[model samples]
Target chain A: MTHIIFDLLHILDEAGIDQPVAGNVISERLGISRTAVWKYVNLLREVGYVIDASAKTGYTLRKRTWLLLPYEVKRYLKTKVIGQEMHHFEQVPSTNALARQMMHEVGDEVQPGTVLIAEQQTGGLGRMNRVWMSPEGGIWATIVVMPKLHVDQIFLITMAASISLARAIRHEFELSALIQWPNDVFIGDKKVAGTTLELAADEDIIKYCLVGIGVDVNVSVEKVMPNLSRLVTSLSDELGHDVDRAQLFSVFLKEFERRYQMMLKGESEPLFREWRSLSRTLHRRVRVRTIRESFEGEALDVDERGALIIHKDNGEIERVIAGDCYLI
Target chain B: MTHIIFDLLHILDEAGIDQPVAGNVISERLGISRTAVWKYVNLLREVGYVIDASAKTGYTLRKRTWLLLPYEVKRYLKTKVIGQEMHHFEQVPSTNALARQMMHEVGDEVQPGTVLIAEQQTGGLGRMNRVWMSPEGGIWATIVVMPKLHVDQIFLITMAASISLARAIRHEFELSALIQWPNDVFIGDKKVAGTTLELAADEDIIKYCLVGIGVDVNVSVEKVMPNLSRLVTSLSDELGHDVDRAQLFSVFLKEFERRYQMMLKGESEPLFREWRSLSRTLHRRVRVRTIRESFEGEALDVDERGALIIHKDNGEIERVIAGDCYLI
Candidate 1:
């Protein structure tokens, strides 16, 4: 029964949204009876798929919910490792928290490219334990990776994720997307997406890494982040249309996989150069606040370890490894 | 009753090992009666304290168990944060495992300098998930630190720990203890201790880090590590006398606290200089084996991020961040 339901969804998905696939055609292709196809199509509709059906024209997929359902994502995902196995939730405490629990429970047995996604999070956290707004209509995901990299090289994982989000948004919508220093993606002068990282490692090897990404896709920025509305925007608000989140996430996985493979091979010069080219913070006057102190400087360059080199006004050149950077 | 018991133990501990204090003396110091003092002394004896008692003289603490009991370690410990709150077990799966679990369960509620220790570990793990030999008479400990450092600077925690062990051993026994890159302590061509690190971090900041140190204190190398007898040694084996583990641990905590403070203040040049001076692997012909490949090189120096710089025989200089190095 499950297989038939999945098969029916696959057929309708291949037919494309708003395009009808005749009932007889789906039955013939899946080697199932027409009655079985009808039953499965009803099941799919019950699970939030909007399908327009008629006796003569068959079924047309009207909409797939914004949720990153595994079947919806895997159908378009092209990466070999990423998204091979996925877990989806309508609401969770946090994808990264659950991912960390899973990593601890099933150490060494967890698949590297497994993905965990949630439509909403009640206890989401940003850097320094700040509460992140994770309402519905946003892409909140954690990708588990077992990279053969040193612990110090872990910032590269965040770099790859941020770059992937930027590239995916740019390629899909032809929008001008830029990367901020460290790991935030911006559209124009406002933030659209951000990335976080968690790692499990010993002295010599990184056992696993969790790269968490939060993109404000179809979120109502004014309603969700009213205090920071001027500093944040959503994709739908920018483009005046809701995006297909599953497709955008699939593009991100592919982009991430390509760069991840390069990093594992010790070929990160190209990635660094790409990050610099797509960077919006470099050579800009920015205020960097670390745990100890805050200072403003011209963002000169990023070193190999992803540390931002800042030339302060006091004629001192400082390397800020981890901090919050704001455009002045 | 618990306070009196604690007071009785404190009196005996202050009187020095095997030095008897009069019953009246303990009773007066604790503001209790002699009968109450005798009862508390009996309670301490039941919990693994070997006490010698006489009606004429008083109670004498003959022995404190080899286990790193909280009272035993805290009595002599004088650190601002490190080991201020300790959890000790007679046997556990692994101190680092329990520490990680506690860190997860408590999150921000956990104290930064909490220490977890075990007399023996049933499933101890070494670097790269190797089986760590955790016999009964070894120092298996994990220190929880919430340093205000970037994720890239985490290796400094391991450096501080390894240096602490080397310094403690040298200061106590006058033996020439040296650190092998990246985090192993050796004495005269044999390994005596090693360190492992685990971290929880986001893209811009580290939430918490667990530094695990395993020292062969009183372990019988031939019995526990028969396959690695020539490569491993214990402190007692080197000193030809059973070392006082609680005293040694207190010294180590002091050593660690000092260096940790220095690292937090960004005064790591002194630490790097100290590590180089006490290093047994630098300036020697070594075999470097990374996950990708292996090659012969001369150990030149370590970079600020703790990466080993090697001059390969092919006239190529390679910076190895995480790998095994063998002196050839």
Candidate 2:
């Protein structure tokens, strides 16, 4: 059910686009009594929406705050599926964790492009159970998607997400952000944002992918975890002012869809080329630590299927599917 | 809480083992009243356990039918974690699907070696969401584990499972079972059993693994699906009588742990050599189909990581990680 308040608010937006809308006009359109319409106007006033009422003009929406309301996000999103169905929560343990649980509960009913956004994640996960400091100022959200890809092609989703985030950063602030291979995005050596892509598969077939994004938008540098502030960079700290998270998120969704369509069409060449240009780990001396083994090698190239090819000192080129690549 | 019925039953077995002990002795041993002891004995008799209860003889276990009860499995289980904590259901949709949900519910509280077993799986999953026909008289189970290995080393779990299953078959019935790479256990040209390994992981760490195994124990060929009957075999069909499922499961759990420990110790040679000996896929003309592409190649050898090394027509040696392999 659409909240009556949202329905009334939407009418106010449509009417106040140019001129004031009369009470009788809204009452007729909504099929409610004039007394009920006036009562709703009073409710809107109580909810903090600035409204002007007169005997001649029914109501006028003077100003609206940029909270991450569904209408506010929908007004900006142009994507087909990504972030199409948004579930906003005030607080969650982790968006990705909640996404996984929801997927299990609904099973196939959980549609792709469904998004779960939170203002804060108390137990937000980093890779390998590491603590992710998801304060209220950061954009802590997870986008659920079902990608038609094989096991080897799973990494392509992560690639698309990273490319989308990088493009969004460039589009929004003209910031030259670098994408660290596999997932994290950085501003120079300091980290501004990161992406974690998780999926459920049956052997080679992928069931769903949960792409989690943590972008430090309006976070204060001094408020970050001790000893990590120097390594972490927030948009507000870099821009010398607060950055609108909803605007950045909207831009990201649009960019994400563009690159996602490219991947669906199997046009990986352009995606790979752009990712290579924005990567800081590529063509660098790095230590790749995998679960089974660790080796130091010169990072050569990432293959079509997203396998990082590294030339070892032992005259062997290793194709690493999943591992930690640390620049030495 | 221990079921009062089971508690009373355990006391009867103990008292009957040495001699036809009196009712007062059983009641004393159990710390229950003589009336409660007799009440439990009658309940056990109703449940199909033959107990000779008299004023002189407290209880005597005459026949214990072969059922995969938790206590029976625990009594036979020698391994540490594989089947230590079992979740048994009379009927379920899929053991793996249930296991995944349980893991999500418990989160980090989920311990390794937890097993989910079902007497029947109505919607058991085969790779790629294919319908796994799990009828009565089949072993439908999933073992949960947290493997500390790289993504590429994932196949090692499947390998150990196959090798352990093959060893168990040979040990129990003295029959030969061949392991087809990636996962299926074959007898001659027909498949007798198969395994499905599913996991939740990022680019680096594995959160958990659910290894689903379906063994055709006492299932009649005619009772199986029409198209699959000809290509599938059963233990009863091969052995000329119904085999004990609890023993087979017990043996499989032990063997799986043995092979699992070997892999953890970095002993891949014994595993590889044994897997090669039992593999019908080695050095065979096969067709490999992956998500990205598919092609015909001669199966040359399997590497330490358990990836099938195929020699293509153009002399390209390709490593096949996950795909359906067909004999040409």
Candidate 3:
């Protein structure tokens, strides 16, 4: 179903926006019935897409009110495969939910760089079971990667993704970005973006990993959850101008591809070094929450396995492989 | 659908060997069609069952099969929830495949102790992208565990399961079972069983963990894959007798529940101790295989994080959090 939608989008892209093109032309181009093309056009309109139609003319792309469509985002994309196969939804409970479903159905057959993107998520999730507010214009995407790496080394992929987002922010808008341990891409003391890494992994091997990332690209701080409103900021809010989300998404996928290739080749040392250089949590006073207990400490460094090393105030050093780290 | 099967099984159990008199009465009592009852009976017979059915009479159990049916296995069961909700398939690509599907559809509403069992798996999986053989009489079951623990501690659940299997084999058959590091359950230095832990988790929190366990019970060594035939042994082969698989499964689920409760309460130290005690890899010469490289060392101990600590020949110690460990 998503493939058919993409096919229609491709036909529309080829038809161009000069004038309304007939359904027969789209049908012939996509190798589908005219009725099927008309159905898809209606679906696009229902999802906030405005298409101008006339008896003599075909369909004109008047306005694209929907966000994160592959046709719109793929224009600036420059990568081998990432984001090449995208599943876009107007309103989904979560992109990760759909990505997980697709990953199970296809398993390792889901090519690396395949992405699941959604405009708005009703049940958007953050790491540690927290809810992420994914309003319209916010980027909710999960990329499927088959690194064929060990389960522990999988964390390196997450670090690479964080670095990609940080680098993209710096290069595109000249905004200084900081990375919180594990997955968040932050700006100064406030969070501008967050990421969650979910895996369909066994003990020794990872079948596939879903790197679900949510960025406050064009979301207003006021529109975010009230509890998180004070702690979070958006790229649009920080830049004092609304950024083009499609362009931002393209930059992220490209950066992600470069880092992901390095990771697959086991060249994560440079990526980790770059990550450390941009990381703000290390060497800062912080508190770490594990299921067993919570501890206050000064963050030291992240080990090769991506475990956070913390030097506690009580003179004890703790290696935290998994937990929530909050900067004090 | 599974709940209905269990209810019907309970009614059949109560009907006993009194054939016509009890079977007809029970079928009518349950308000189900008599042909539907007979169909369930025929279904059981097709799967290696040896029930005595007469046209003028009803069904009588002449002999119990070694199949892992809920009715047959749950007779001696003792667990709060681990195997309470059962799903049995005659042939599936993988039990993990079915469990992953159920996890999505059921979400958090999935009952704890839910078991997905399959008789034959065409595409059974092992750790690190290996294939697991699931022929008839071998146990292919995945138990859904919802533990309110940090994602890092999730490995402890796997460790505890290995310990439980080891203890169950030792107590039930008086066999000296040894646990290989991470997953494989062994007997006399040969692989007798194996386990794979799949998680729907992020860095800090675990949504659920599906512990897919495959034990070569009551299976002939000649039936196994040629490459693995020599390296593996079954409980039947080890004991030199056809062990009752239903009884063994009941004992394992009972033991698993006890250990799982301890893990959920953050009491993994005792479970870890038991794992070390039962482990054959500890203090033994072994080789650990990771994606980067393979290293030879003497297994020292498993840390609190369930990572294997290996002391190299050069006196350097390596902490392997996730990998394939083989006895050398």
Candidate 4:
């Protein structure tokens, strides 16, 4: 139902861009009454969307603001499952948290490709409960997927997400963004975006995977934590202009689905190749700290199942399943 | 509050074992009023507990039915977390399903060591959504735990559960139960019990793990699926008497936590050694089928991370992470 109005709004937008378009023409083409057209305009206005509706002229979109609204996302959303049914929240504690809650409520009824988007998260969560500064302009979203894979291959979901995020940044802004070992996305030594892949599964079956991604889009360094300012960078700060978050988000879902599908189809060479090519942590002196132990080593490569293979200084090769990776 | 009433019920039980005990005598010892004791007795009767009250003899517990009530579990529960908060459902779709739902609702506030038990689950689940035959006398329960471990070490949780279950069966019935690789508990090659470990976690953190265990206690083979009659065994059928469900459950939790704490403290060698010794899959020709592929190999020892090390016929060592092992 929202998608129908979203499509009508786009038609009005195209007509508005040229000149004032007639009400009857839109009504005739859309096969809806003129009163129906006026109803939608009022609905848009109530949601803070400005629609220029005159007696002679049909409804014209005066502006399409950068809101992570469902209608706005549906305009750019082009995927079978990922974001096919989008739930947009203006302000949430964390999109990842909400997605997990929704998954529980709906149970198996929840679709695989559903995406949850939030404009700002008061308590946005990064990996290991780290506070992600999700201000008004940041892209805080979580995409849910049900991958058919073994438990060992679950890490590949994170790997695929990392590759997709890096690719999305490169495609949208033409920036040379690289992946920093497990999940952080960076551009030329400064971090731009990061992803946290959360999964729920039985021993032999994966229930669902929530790919929570937070990208610093239009926020400044000062808007984030003071200490993080030295290490973090946003798309707007690097690009010199506020980027379209809706476009960036939609592009990311497409890239993620592509990589995710390949993984489900039992292809690792491409994902590994892409991840290895974009990863800066590989072949660098690194410190991997886990809950059990921490060690300093030179990261050789990520294995097929996404385990980071590292060669310790004293000559022991270690395979880290998951940990905090620091490039020293 | 429930625990206090549970304590009162135990007192009435002990006094009633020999003869009918007076309510005033019970109240004097417990330091509660006669009215307070009567209120507890009435509450117990409302839940289908039978208590015989004569004006001369006072209150006597006539019968404690085979019900997995909150008070029944709380009476025996002792631990820091695992069974500290118990949710007893008479007929849930699945204990594991309810446990996961509770975890979602309470979020992280749902403490570790919380246990969910059901008298009968209409749709009791095994691993990979298999329908577990949870009859009236069977034990259908799920224990929620928040283990701090690497993703690779996640398998140890299942291993710990297997050992705990085997030990509990041995302690309760003096039966020789063995551990099946991945998760089935068997006695003399006939399966007596099984466990399904469901986990919701991020790459770096575990949200919660629901260890769903189903034990055929008082249930007979005829009550289970007819096809499984030849391969399944129960504690009662072997001992010729109904084993106490609450006793078996409480014992299992204590054993589980002891092994769980050992794993958390990085003492996994003992668990691995125990699992290897009891494993029926080890040193046997087994066909392990994972999501992507399947292979026939000699099942060697399970590695520290709980990967089944299989020596393939053609001379390659295959590590089966999460799979179905069929002895061939």
- Top model number, lDDT: 1
Q: How close is candidate 4 to the true structure, as a TM-score?
A: 0.48
Pull out the clashing pairs in model 1.
Answer: none
**Alpha carbon deviation, residue A193, candidate 3 (Å):** 70
Task: Give the number of colliding residue pairs in candidate 3.
Answer: 7
- For model 3, the superposed segments whose C-alpha errors exceed 4 Å read A1-328, B1-12, B15-23, B32-40, B54-58
What digit string (tens of lDDT, one per residue) describes model 3 on residues A1-328?
2457667766666676655677667778778655445546655654556776554566788776446777778889998878887766666788888677555433434567788788888999999879888898789999988778899898888898899999889999998998999789989879988889988767788878889888998877876666677788999889887888888889999999999999888898898899899998999999999989999999999999899999999999999988989999
For model 2, the interface Cα RMSD in angstroms equals: 27.1
Query: Can you write out model 2's per-residue Cα lDDT over B1-328, one digit (the tens) per residue?
Result: 0246666667656655444656667678778655445545544544346766544444677755354655657757899878877766666678897777656534454568878778889899887777888988888999988877777777788889988888899999988898987789988777888888898986778877898899988888766666787788888988889987888999999999999889878887888888889898988999999989899989999887678999998889999877889888
Error of 1 at A297 (Å): 99
- Model 2 off-target regions past 4 Å? A1-328, B1-6, B15-23, B38-48, B52-56, B291-294, B313-315
DockQ of each: 0.01, 0.01, 0.01, 0.01
Candidate 2: pairs in clash:
none
TM-score of chain B of each: 0.91, 0.89, 0.90, 0.89
* Model 4 chain A worst lDDT run, 10 consecutive residues: A38-47
Q: Write the per-residue lDDT of candidate 1 for residues B209-313, one digit (tens) a residue.
A: 999999999888987789998999999889887888888899999999999999999989999999999999999999999999999989999998899999999
Native contact recovery (fnat) for each candidate is 0.00, 0.00, 0.00, 0.00
lDDT of 3 by residue, B199-291 (tens): 887667887899988999888887666677778999988877788888888899999999999887888888988998898999999999987
